[model samples]
Every structure is written in structure tokens, then in C-alpha cells.
Target: MGSDEDAVLAGPFWYGRWDETAREHHGGHARQLNRAARAAHYAEGAFDPDATRAAIAGLEIPVLILVGELDFSPSPVLATQLGELFAPGWVRLVVQPGAGHHPWLDDAARFGDVVTRWLAGS
Candidate 1:
């Protein structure tokens, strides 16, 4: 992302709550940094709608959808859509507060607890 977009979009890419450690860590290991800009272009082409429909229809088992509260890209809104798609069954949707795209980095303890509880069927 450009400098102007970094202040906003980049935050979602990393963490909602920024710190020196977070900045240093992500900066040192910015995976796919070279092709970040081209990702949009690569994703713009047509996708297989039939495959997507079949995949959604095949999700018969319970699902636990987690989203960061501060993530704008795949925010809780997207999680809600997934929940709807997995309808007529148990679909747990979690919006971890103050979390960005990487919820574990934003709130590791909470993320672990949530996932543990979900896995334990609580």
C-alpha cells in the first residue's frame, strides 16, 4: 500500500492496536511485500461461482468464524455473511474486541481463550 493508504489499510493488515514491537516485528517480516500491490489485480479476474456455491453448500458441519473487530476488509460483516451461509446449524461468530486482521497478535490471550472454548464445545 502507498504511504497515504498505509495509515489506514496497513493497520488492518497488521494490528488494530499498534506498538513498537508490533511495528518492528511486522516490518522485519513483511511477507509478500513485493507483490502486495499486484494482489488486487490478480484477484480481480473472474472466479468460479459454481465451485463457490458447491463449497458453501457442502459446509454441513458446525463452523467457528472469528473476525477482528477493527478489521475493515474481512470485518464482522463478512463473518455474518458466512454465518448466514452456514445456516440451520451452529455457526459461532466471534468478534474479538480491539483486534485487527491478525487477532492473535492484537489480543493473543483472548484469541487463545476464545478458540479453546470453542474447540471444547463450550
Candidate 2:
């Protein structure tokens, strides 16, 4: 995330819910730092096309690509790419309006509805 967002989530004065220690230990300090270090180490710059394309093309199971309307992390356009990764007609794209990165956290009702409908269709 960018600076403002990161500050609100992690800064001492901005985080009204808890102190710095608590924030660091949201998943426990050791685990959190370990995860952060690992992520930094494996950070991406260029794509490994052959590996990525082959992995996607190899999947034969049904796939549901769900993205939030406000989430540009992976973007809704990714749904089309993901759909092509699965068997034809076996991929569904669901977008929840007004939702951000975590759609279920943003709107449980809509998220549940989508999941229920998908299960019913299956």
C-alpha cells in the first residue's frame, strides 16, 4: 500500500485501535516479521512467462475469480486472464461493488450471496 494507507494501518498516532506492539504482533511479531522478510526477498520485477502461462494453462478445474470493485491490486481484468487459464465455460468472474481488497470484510451479505449462488449453480 501507499504512504497514507500504510500510516493509517501502522503508524502510532494514526492507529487508534492499538499500540505499535500490538500492530506488530497482529499475527505475532515473529511470524509477522518472518512473513515480511520472505515477501521482500521474493519480490517480483520481471515475469517468468513460460512458468506462469504454463501453470495457468495446465489447470483443468473450475475457477471463480472474485475481485472487489475498488480493488486494483489484481484488477477485474485479471478475471478474463484467469478464465482462460481454466477449462472453457468453467470459470466465473464475480465483482462486488463498493468492496475493496477484502470483499467479505467489506460486505458479508453480497459475498455470501455470490458464494451461495455459485454453490447452487454447481
- Residue 33 alpha-carbon offset, candidate 2, angstroms: 7.3
Quote the positional error of residue 116 for candidate 1 in Å: 0.4
List where candidate 1 sits over 4 angstroms from the true fold.
1-13, 31-46
Candidate 2 per-residue C-alpha lDDT over 40-104 given as tens digits, one digit per residue, 9 for 90 to 100: 76678546778877887777766778787766656667756666766677778987887655576
Error of 2 at 47 (Å): 5.4
For model 1 the local lDDT of residue 103 reads 88
TM-score for each model = 0.72, 0.61
**Model 1: how far residue 81 lies from native, Å:** 0.9
**Which candidate has the top score in TM-score?**
1
Off by over 4 Å in 2: 1-47
lDDT tens readout by residue for model 1, 26-101? 6655563666665764575546667776787677777888899988768789878867766467788999999887
Clashes within 3 Å, all models in order: 0, 0
Q: Which ten residues in a row have the lowest lDDT in candidate 2?
A: 11-20
lDDT of every model, 2 decimals: 0.76, 0.64
